[model samples]
Target: MTSHRRPSSPRLGLAALACGAGLALGGCHAERIVADSYPTTVAQRHPIVLAEGSTRLDLPVGAGAQGLTSRQKEDVRAFAADWRKNGRGPIGMMAPAGAFGATAVRSALASAGVPATQIVSQRYTPAGPEEIGLVKLGYVKLKAQVSHACGLWPDDLGSGGGDLYGATENREYWNFGCANQQNLAAQVADPEDIARPRAEAPIYAARRQTIIEKHREGGDTTTGYRQADAVVSDVAKE
Candidate 1:
């Protein structure tokens, strides 16, 4: 003989309903409960600087490449000229020696509005003495001092990311969710999920503000200025 248990009574159903209602109410309360509050304007307190005199830009070259093509060189020169005309100061660029050499950068600076006299190129040999080893060595360095009095470099420096200036400006670095959130903040966008708020929002806002302030104060160190170009490049690709 087979015996079966009876179904749960209406009382049980009523209890479940009550529990669900309590949970929903609790959630609403939680959302309304404002936790410890701090100043909201911390992020906004920082100012942004857009241009400055004479900045260094770095470009990386792939291995085994020759040099920048004539057209590419022209493009760089034009960019430099524009930056100069716009009060960006002196514009300099660096790249690997082989194909994307200093000549290409010089051309770009010329195109960008810089006169040929203002363009300067140098070769950077690797630091260590493993000269004949398997490691490749040969890099082209370019430097331009911005002729105008502007703060573009400092502002760009503090913004973080690998910029054209080749500086690592991101201070509150993180992984996974936080990293994503910080990246979003860099773009000044609303983040999409909870992890971002919990892990990234506060720090990113603080860092951004700091960078802005530094720019405003005329912070000239390349500490934050170096990676602007690269960051811009990656963002463009994305």
Candidate 2:
């Protein structure tokens, strides 16, 4: 018995060659096409930035008011506390020239636990008649903010300006997720949280001891609720 070997078809060989050439051409075209595909992620496009900025509070003074009002005192206290936490330079207090609230502002800051040496008192000419009695307090502090400006439309979202193929690539536009990034930056309490995590807080030693003792005695280790009604549940109870 003689074995017959089948010859390869020329048409099949030519078809394979054409297919490979087509793929190669497609890849070259893909590389040559100029697509603005940088900053693939929204975070990369609009990153959060930490920078030195000023925090300000304005307290209005009435004609006959002797000192800061109750509301003004609260605002000043909060401002002082925030300054102690994040501020680096001295806290600045600017009051209108000949304003009666100048002394009150200093007293309020001192009452809020701010050192008298750390407060810098200054007087400024009022911009207008309405601002004659306004007291401005501020401090320089590090703040977290978005790097890019929001509400910008550099590129057309629609298939215009020779970007039809780019639109079809399913890539995000230039201003995508900008508002979200800004919101995230604004919501961050500390600017350092963006750079790195903070040190772990100390554990509750008393709570840990209680749990451990309960576990050793084979008693319930879970937290006991004195008022059962405080717990929220949708299931029907017996």
Candidate 3:
């Protein structure tokens, strides 16, 4: 028996419902919760998506297939910026000796605010005549990337083959949460913050001592009520 099936977008469905119910203003928020069931969703992954590691850019010869094209120049700048954001240590740039745009690539790296001293240059030689030349980019950083592959609709949704919950309630498939999780991973600036939080701000010891003294005499600890843009005490006294 042939079964006709139309793919369902959980996000779009929630958006339509929100609009019909006159909740168009807060509709975007409602849409966000529709697919977030990895921990809160029906379908989940084993290792989860947040556990991340190093990512590398095996720089392809996309620009002109010569030294470095404008596109390649931009790529170097972007790569350096990303490296400075999280990854530390010396950055490496490998280019074939006779490549067309090596100077342009070096200039781009400098433009990206990377100190030339921090970069270690290496001569790249092709393995064979047929092999295309490429400038490799790599760095170690705490990357919050997806651990699983998406678009994994194992059984046909229409036929109602596998688990009964999906067919009866029309729930999402296993890979439903992967894309949103991947997006969340990509948006994060500091991935190490996920593993451990940053140190807290320093405390005001003088203020604490003053508050303690006030409390001993049964006085209110709250004292200062300065407005924003207030002048310094020395300037105000003058």
- Considering TM-score, where higher is better, how would the candidates rank from best to worst? 2, 3, 1
Per residue, candidate 2 scores C-alpha lDDT tens digits across 64-99 of 457987899999999989998999799888777777
TM-score of each: 0.27, 0.71, 0.47
- Superposed Cα deviation of residue 32, candidate 1 (Å): 21
Worst lDDT run of 10 residues, candidate 1, spans 132-141
Give candidate 3 misplaced runs (Cα > 4 Å): 1-81, 98-118, 124-138, 165-172, 198-201, 204-210, 222-238
| Candidate 3 per-residue C-alpha lDDT over 30-106 given as tens digits, one digit per residue, 9 for 90 to 100 | 32333323342633452334553564555556334545556767777778878888775677667665665555666
What is the TM-score (0 to 1) of candidate 1?
A: 0.27
Predicted candidate 1 versus true structure: per-residue lDDT over 1-238, tens digit per residue:
9999999999999968877887887732323233333223322222222222343334443434346666656545555544543432333343333434455455545555567665444445544443311112121222222223222232343455424223332232111133333343445322222123445445588667878888999995345445544677788899
Question: Each candidate: what lDDT?
Answer: 0.42, 0.82, 0.66
RMSD of each: 23.5, 9.9, 16.9
lDDT of 2 at 126: 68
Assess the local accuracy of residue 13 in candidate 2 as a C-alpha lDDT between 0 and 100. Answer: 88
Rank the candidate models, highest lDDT first: 2, 3, 1
Better of 2 and 3 by lDDT: 2
Worst 10 residues of 2 by lDDT: 27-36
Model 2 has an lDDT value of 0.82
